[model samples]
Target: MISRTLETTLNALALYAIAAVLGVAFFDQLVNGELPCPLCLLQRAGFLLLAIGPVLAVARGPRAAWYGVTILAGLAGAGFATRQILLHIAPGDAGYGAPFLGLHFYTWAFVVFVVAIAASALMLILRQPDGEATDEVQAGAASGDALGRIGILLVILMAAANVLSTTLECGFATCPDDPVTYQLLTPSGS
Candidate 1:
């Protein structure tokens, strides 16, 4: 029974939530000096792509197309996280990167990806009214202007943060495949 405006707002909030989670991870990396591995970077890419869904939903109202974008991005992120998890399946293995609260970043990334998929699916379901198509699809996006603005702002901030962190981590070039330390800080670019 949710209205399109409400649904759009919810999607915006969900996107912001995902951005916040990634922000926390970035902070953790900065604090602990933990350079992200290849899989971790891939997961970050997935998250960034998934975040676009909310902005689109807000800009155009609730549409299955936007949710589809989220779902696909989530699946890609989940795959990356799962691959990283499998790398350390053996007992007594030190695992990649630093662990947050005893769980690695990739593990958290997996959880976030699964949540994204679920949220996108739910939004898609709620977008339909009484199990039929409705005019909400063509409704004015201006109704969700406030939420849309916030979503767009969050996207900008997230992009800037990622750019800063990535630059600091890898400098003006590509990051190493399995970086154990920040490339910019390492002597002779080891």
Candidate 2:
């Protein structure tokens, strides 16, 4: 019972964190008119992928597979963020995108991914299995609960918002190498 609860809470926390950050990014783009670069878009995709694990955890209860998803997504995002950081390592190179609270968005993304990995690892290590019958019952019951519903809703909303924004920014193809503005929105051949 305790393990299940802990896993559920951790999953909820992860989902909420991802949503909050995405919300901030959305507002920053909508209100500030700052367009995300291609790498930033990739990092956003990573965050969306990372959220899948937590959403699964909430909907299906604690499972190793869900945690595995989080770990893999986190590592991928971290790698991309690290590469971007290295690109700006030279003196006065001005990192890609705007900095938030003294750190670039990619830096924050790297930190979030690392933290997700750590949290998922801890959950995996600390999980104590209930009997199969009890687990099945709990998972089924939990799936219909309020938190699970909220998790599903958030995932849908975030995914929809991301798809819309990406479409507006990149249209039906790949984004530019260093997108400072919306490509699809611009006049043809500009």
Candidate 3:
């Protein structure tokens, strides 16, 4: 029972951390008016993907399969970020969008993905199997704690915001390689 509670708490914290990263990305997009490139969107998707495992763990108890999902998402996200970083590797290239804290969003994404992967791996290593499953331990996860619930809600909200923003920016067409304005919002004659 204790271990289960600990796991749930940890999952809640992970969810909050992931949500914060998503929140920062969203804030930058809105406040700076810098549209996300395709790769940037992919990285955001990766972050959402990474959150799934923890969300499941909080809602349905920790499972190895869920952690595996997180690890895979982290790997995919890191690869996307790496591709973007490589694109701007040339000495004189100005880099994509703008730098946040002296590093591009992709760079920060890469770092976050690495840290998430490591943390998931550590959680997997530390998780303890229930010796004799009590009803409380078995069913407790269904009633996730308040913190976990809040974290889950925040992530969901972020996902919805991303979808709305992306639709506005790209419309139904492929997003431009270097988007200067919201395609759907712009005058058709412009």
Which candidate has the highest lDDT of all?
Answer: 3
Model 3 CA lDDT for position 6? 74
- TM per prediction: 0.84, 0.89, 0.92
Sorted on lDDT, highest at the top, how do the candidates line up?
Answer: 3, 2, 1
Candidate ordering by TM-score (highest first): 3, 2, 1
Assess candidate 3 and give its TM-score to the true structure: 0.92
lDDT of 2 by residue, 97-155 (tens): 67899999889989989998998888777776534434556565766777667766876
Which parts of model 3 are misplaced by more than 4 Å? 130-143
Overall local distance difference test of candidate 1: 0.76
Number of backbone collisions per candidate, in order?
0, 0, 0
Candidate 1 ranges with C-alpha deviation above 4 Å: 129-144, 172-174, 178-181, 185-190
Which pairs of residues clash in candidate 3, taking residues 3 or more apart in a chain or in different chains?
Answer: none
Worst 10 residues of 2 by lDDT: 129-138
Best by the TM-score measure: 3
Assess candidate 2 and give its lDDT.
0.80
Tell me which of candidates 2 and 3 scores higher on lDDT.
Answer: 3
